[model samples]
Target: MEQERLVLEVDVRVAQPRAPRRGGVELDPIDRDLEYTGSLLTLLDPLGLLGGVTVVALSLTHGAFFLALKTTGTIREDARRLGTTLGAVTAVLAVVTLGWLGLLTGSAWSWATTVVAAVALLAAVAANARGREGWAFTGTAVTAAATVATYFLALFPDVMPTTLDGGRSLTIANASSSPMTLQIMTWAAAVFTPIVLLYTGYTYYAFRRRIGTQHIPEPVAVG
Candidate 1:
């Protein structure tokens, strides 16, 4: 199932590599280069690919930690083992990728988030080692948050850099909606955010119990 999903993802990426560029009025250097090359292989940016892999590793590690927290017996033991191994891999990949991004961006905010992400990942690994699954989950959550924050902080001010000489880059100032639109969005978010949060919290609370193989029903053979 995982392999099939990955294959489908790759096919989608190959078929619609420009999906990310849609709805953007201006092109960044990488996007412009992609356009110039017009090849599916051109989508392979080493740093970007590393970052993507790091995220995937982090997600897998997170899932393992979650399973360790919510399962019993052999399944929990397996989850712990898998989580530890994947956490180590995630730490290495995250450190390299985030450090590279921090240096490339050269911003205090980016560097700060990079450090936070590294520290969070380390904490998660340590927590998992100590059999503290909850803390491990929290740590991985923080790491994911920090990673995303670093990316956005690095891209601040200028949403996209100009590829052509003398071309105006897409900036937050240029890309932002009108004040009225912003106001409406702010009000709407304020009104709906709490309701959404309440619903999510209640949903999680309802299904918070741990489960094991014993909970599974035997499949009835239809003759």
Candidate 2:
């Protein structure tokens, strides 16, 4: 929504394309210089609203699956049951939204990723039904990854598409920074990513045990 408000809703096209793409950006017709002009909408349209709802539903379903996988006793049981229900709802919404995107974009890669997403979601639901929380979690994770891939594939060269005018869309070629900046960013990621990953792994390893109500201390009596 923010992207729509800030970039997508308005026409940000230049008369000519940018010069000298040193960062290997695949230039398309949508690749133009930024010069914002036109109005912005206070809210998204009906289809955009539906997309937002689908996104929220997906997040809720993902959370339910995570809870089912992590906790124990009543929480786990409740989460497992809820995850199944939410999964069904998410699947329906996902089909509608993703199908619309596939039709709109008409990209073969997007269609392939959409199929993967559907299969992963179904697998997650099935795993949850059989009380295989670990597999269920993995399935949901894969579903999420596939869904994101589908969206990106659908987007293709365009990073931010314009509903106002197709030609006004922001392409990766227009959005990319200079080669020097990208190289610095690459080195920065290489240096810092492993440290972040190590910290995350250590945190998970330290608190890996599953907890239930039994682990919670009783409230102290107030005098």
Please provide, for model 1 over 53-122, each residue's C-alpha lDDT reduced to its tens digit, 9 standing for 90 to 100.
9999999999999999898888988999999999999999998888776666648989998899999989
- Please state every model's RMSD to the true fold in angstroms: 11.0, 9.6
CA displacement after TM-score superposition, residue 137 of candidate 2 (Å)? 1.1
Off by over 4 Å in 2: 1-33, 36-38, 162-168, 221-223
lDDT for each residue of candidate 2 in 1-223, tens digit (9 for 90 to 100): 8988767445555443342221222122332345443324313344456678887887887888778777899999999999999999989988988887777674988999999999999998999999998888888789889988988999989786653333477778877999999999999999999999999999878877877889999999999
- Winning candidate number (lDDT): 1
TM-score of each: 0.77, 0.78
Model 2: ten consecutive residues of lowest lDDT: 19-28
Q: Model 1, stretches more than 4 Å misplaced? A: 1-27, 30-43, 218-223
Model 2 TM-score?
0.78
